[model samples]
Target: MQIRDLPYADPGVPDVRSGTRFLLWLGRQQLGGQVKCLLWGLLHHLGIAGLPLGVGLAVQAVVDRDGGRLALAGVLLLALGAAIAAGDVMLHRTAVTNWITAAARVQQLLSRKTAELGSVLTRRVAAGEVVAVSTGDVERIGWFVEALSRFAAAAVTLVVICVGLVVYQPALGVVVAAGIPVLALAVLPLLPHAARRADVQREKAGKATELASDTVAGLRVLRGIGGEELFLGRYRAASQEVRRAAVHSARMWALIAAIQVVLPGLLLIAVVAYGTKLALDGRIEVGELVTVYSAVALTHHALRNFEEIAQAFSFSRPSAKRAARVLSLTRTTTTVPKPREVEAGGDLYDPLTGLRAPAGLFTAVVCGDPDVAGRLADRLGGHPTEPDADHTSVLLGGVPLDELPLEDARTVVLVQDKEPVLLSGTLRELLDVPTSGKVRAEHALAAAQCDDVLDALAQASVATGGDPMLTRITERGRSLSGGQRQRLALARSLFADPEVLVLDEPTSAVDAHTEAAVATWIAELRRTRTTVVLTSSPLVLDRAHCVVLVHEGQAVAVGSHRGLLATEPRYRAVVTRETDEELATADGRAVELDALEGESA
Candidate 1:
């Protein structure tokens, strides 16, 4: 396949048995690219090796005063130079191609695995590890793969040049050949230490990255709870640890590099001194002495490849291990999916919680604990639930929801998570998914009260022919406000228009007016579909056809919002958080504070 056709239509199932196996699997997948790289690299190095021979021949031709031979030497030099240049260019191009395509293939595989695991991935793998795998680890793995082919080429070039030298001049050739092994093996002792230090550095870096992300995600909460400094201190300490580990790792690698340099220089000096004595004593010709010197000098380049490949493996091995570990994550919190379709038009029932949403109706679930509500929502959609509990799978039309094929189950029910992500793309790209063709994008945007968001997006970027859908958004919608991002996510979910829609606190981030508008539109939009909303907002609950109150992990009450409020004391206190007098007193305090601020102004 062409390099442009990379990231294969199917990346194929990866072998996540172990890190080394995974790396080998990646290499096997790109065998064709690797071969091209190896071929071009060998040609490039061979061409380079030929240059020293041509120079030696030219020197000999000049010494002999043979005009025709001298001219032949010049022509050979020109031809070899040209070959070297062309080979170098093609070699680099192919190697980089292999690197990029391999990385892309791994990225595609990670994305596919993530899509399969969903929430189960986060539960099983650390956030930092995933970040490291998706970002730095991918590059490291590709680097190793790219280096492998070049290293092979360098090794072959060194051997071929040594053999040629030996046939031309046995005495010097043997000396140079003997030293090549020493230069290659001199740094072997330091490799284990360097690898260990690098692994430590990588581990420290991953931890720091995870800590930084967590701090940023909850910066507001941290400040509110007066723990910002605590987290900042922790991140700072983690950063310091990473820095120290990196410095120590660099020192070890630098020592190996010094050894590579000093040993090769020593070998070159010995070869040159010995060759000079041979030339002066009439044991070898001037040109032969020069050839021997240049050949030994050239072997230094090949020797460096050994070190390069060794270091590449040291770094990439751990990276591959982390990536493989992430890919190995299974849905331990849920049962395996069955390869069958879920029957349509069935009640969404969670047996563990004894909560049932009748077919083709808007059902609202209220749980004081957001965690409980979230778990319930996940159970409704056949997602990971409490790992400690052996929760029975939710049922859809009398069939286990988790038993259906992944696509079939997802087609039947889409759970709009509490914090739906907005990947960077044009608005159209974000909303354009495998939809049911019932609800249009425009209608979804309108229903979600995203008109302001659209206008803001258009005004933010008019370059897309003034089309809001064509407007560009930054990653995670960082440029937009929380409510705006939330609305856009809701619009995307609505556009899918699944047979059964389960939204967990969909409108929580929105303003009261927007929430009220969205709640009303949602009731109208999915009036005929089996829609379940987990929310405690009075605005959303009042609009539901039925509201189920969950307490201590079970459905304790089921009725209309008004009826439950009027009759259920526990539900009323949990939802309202205050009695009538206390609520009035809180309002009075808010008014008094406002008046005091007005007087101060």
Candidate 2:
């Protein structure tokens, strides 16, 4: 795979069984590229190996006083140099292509996983770990993959040189061949130590990266609570720990590098010394002695490739494992046989909680614990946020929610989260999400009570003298206020106009007046659709056709807002936070107003 073919037409499923297996899978995917890289690398190393033979021939030609042999040696030398240069350039290009393509494939896989899991991904995996895996870990995996071809070529070259040396001069060949293995395997003992240190350093670095990401994500909240300095101090401590771990890891690797250099130098010295002794004894010619000496030096260079390959594996193993872990995550729910589509405008019923949002009605679910409400909201959709089988089946139009295709289920029931993300884009682009297009943008904005948001966006755009639809939003809409962001998210959901809309605390960030307006508009606009709102606010509950009071993770009472106020004590405590007498007086006045309206009619 080349860089241009990137984002592979088919990234293909990864082998998530193990880190080593994953690396092998990547190599298999780019077998053609690997082969090309190997060929070029082999030619390059062979050229280097031939240099000694060329020099020896040249020396013999000079001693024999043969001009023709000398000219032939010069031509062979130039050809070898050309081969080396061409091989080096192509090898580099192919290696880089392999590296980039491998990384891109991994990134594509991660991105697909993220989309499939949605918000639940962060719950299952640490945000920092995901970032680290997608960024640094991917590169490390690619690096190892690219290095494999070079390592293979180096191994082949070492063997060929060993055999060539033995054929040319067996006495010197024995010493050089014996020493090459030692040079290659000498770093084996120190590798475990280096790998352990690298693991420690990587762990510390991940923690530091996670801490920084968390700090930046909540910087606004920290500043608001006057805790920025606390987080900053914590980050500084994490950074220092990472630095220390890095230094320790570098120290181990430095020792290995020293060994790599020192061991090879010793072998070179031994070969040269032995060859000199043979030459003095007239056992080997001067030209043959020079070739043996130069081959030893070239072999030392090849041994460095072994050191690099060892380091690459040490760093890439853990990274590949992390990536494999993420890829291995599968949905806990069993695949639904004969997956079906959900009927439009069907009732949403959760058997576990005995909470039902009847078709074409606004139902409010009030729970003492926000977490329970959030889970219930997720359950209303086909996908449960928690990976527990204990969750009871939810049905839409008598079809099990989980049995519907994911996309079909999502189309039938749109769940607007408590903290919905507003991706960075223009106002129009934000609202242009996939939807049935039954609701107009202007009407949805009105239903969501986003007048202030539109005005703010307009003002900002005007200041910059740009079109409002073209105004750029900051990442996560950080520049917008909490309430504005919330309203914008609500507007986006309203624009979707799905069959059933499950909103979890949609107006929690807004003031009482705006919340009341939003509730009224939502109820009015969605009167003919199934809308299940998970909120305890009196304004929204009063607007609901039916209010289900959830306690201990179960719906204990279901009734009209006024009837529940006059009845269920837990309901009153959760929603109103008022005494029975105050509620009673309110209920009495409500009854009196109903009587008055009846008499007038």
Candidate 3:
């Protein structure tokens, strides 16, 4: 079956049984191609199998010393040579087609799975593991697929030669028959070890690859913390371990190769010895002996294919497993199918959890563990997950959150992360995220207090197309300062202007003055729509209409920030620290800190 026909529903939720079934199903999709390849492979190999017979016939004619027969034999040899040449070409071409198609199908499945899992894919599997699957894994899978037809051809050729040998001379045929099983069975014992080593090698390689990817991704952070050398040392250790695994794997394969060569040679020796004895005893003719020996010699090539198929299968199985593991992740958070359109202005409610973000009000979420807040944000946006959880989702108006279609849910509920991604593009593009130019970019920019960011963009000449003024944003907007990136991200979210906005630490990177400005402006601008901010910043929290204090991952107190300060000691302490910081900064008096430094200098 062609890879294109393979079923790939729910790409991220990989079912290995289903994956195998899909591959089998794909074979059915391209029955015609498979049939053609099989036929061509058989014909090609059979033609090659005929060469030895033709040579034997010529030898027989020469032994009988008939001139007319010799001429016929020469003609037969010429024809056999031509057939073998043609068969070789067809065989190679069909095998390559099989390989390419199989690899293409696997690639399609991998691509589909990547899309289905989205960001969750990186959380579950390493980026390097994905890379390994795409490159080494697909190739190994293709090898097994291409090996199928070649294997069939080899089997057919083996049968034809064995039959021909038996029919031509029973005495020589007995020896050929006995040696054939030995040649085939001798490699079996070694296969398990080889397969084991190959599996281990692939695993080690994947780990090393994952380590490298993580190291590179965190290189900036490592450098900032003076841990680059330490990480590099760890990576070097990982590389060495991978090297050791590779050498061990190679050693096993080398042994297998040595065995394949030695056993075949021994079989040929036994065949020749038995044939010569039978020929001297007049039980087999010299010409028949030659044909039997030649068949046995040629069969070695076919037997080697068995070894290759085994090796390829060993490599491919683990890759398939890895790919399958990635595809198996189902969203644990559940949402309703077909979410109803809200009245454009209403409260967002989570009926299951009895949590509500009041409509047209600035609601603040205070979770002790920020991760829980992040997860809630993910669920609030209606990402996929299980339905059985205790969590009821935030809904709009009276409708359940789960009822919304994925696209509509995202459209109505925009979740701006603390560290929003700034894709590579002009500053204009960064400001206009998910931009269809629907929202007035200037209004959103103003609300998010992004005037300075805009000024910097204009000053830096950031534009799209060939304009040198348009500065290309480095990956993740690393070229910009942390505060600039944060404000730009905030601007993008504001531009979306969904019915409900979920902001997670949106102003964490900005200075206190900027944070207070943004918080006040957001509260003013989003007065007519629902806004939920997940943060611990007092500047932002003080402006919220309602503040929910979450402890141990559950909302235990719901009140205004001031009310919470009066009632909750934990909340009081957190806020008091911030108040102290503000007071300290405001005091302006220096305690001879610079004077002491000057004296020391």
TM-scores of the models, in the given order? 0.83, 0.92, 0.81
Question: Which prediction has the highest lDDT against the true structure?
Answer: 2
Per-residue error for 32 in candidate 1, Å, reads 1.3
* Cα lDDT over the full model 3: 0.73
Q: State each model's CA lDDT, in order.
A: 0.86, 0.87, 0.73
Candidate 1 residue-wise lDDT, 1-601, digit = tens: 4677865898878898998899889889888877888888887888878877888888999999888888888898898888878878988898898888888988998998788767656656877778888999999999998888999899888888778888999989998778887888888889999999999999999999888877876766687799988998898899999999999999998899999899889988998888888888999999898888888777777778898999999999999999988877654356565456666788988888899999999999999899888777777877764564665788899988767877787788888878888899999999979898989999999999998998898887757777887889988887788889889989888889999999999998988898999999998988889999999899999999999999998899999999998778668877788777775686688789989999999
For model 1, which pairs clash? none
**Deviation in Å, model 1, residue 109 alpha carbon:** 1.7
Q: For candidate 2, what is the total of clashing residue pairs?
A: 0
Residue 139's lDDT within candidate 2 is 96
User: Where does model 1 exceed 4 Å of error?
Assistant: 61-72, 118-131, 211-241, 273-285, 330-338, 351-354, 385-392, 424-430, 440-446, 449-481, 510-517, 549-573, 576-601
Candidate 2 positional error at 232, Å: 1.1
lDDT by residue for model 3 over 444-471, one digit each (tens)? 7777777776666666663443342266
Arrange candidates by TM-score, descending.
2, 1, 3
Candidate 2 lDDT over 282-316, as tens digits, reads 88888888888888887766777898899999999
The model with the greater TM-score, 1 or 3, is 1
- Candidate 3's error at 534, in angstroms? 1.5
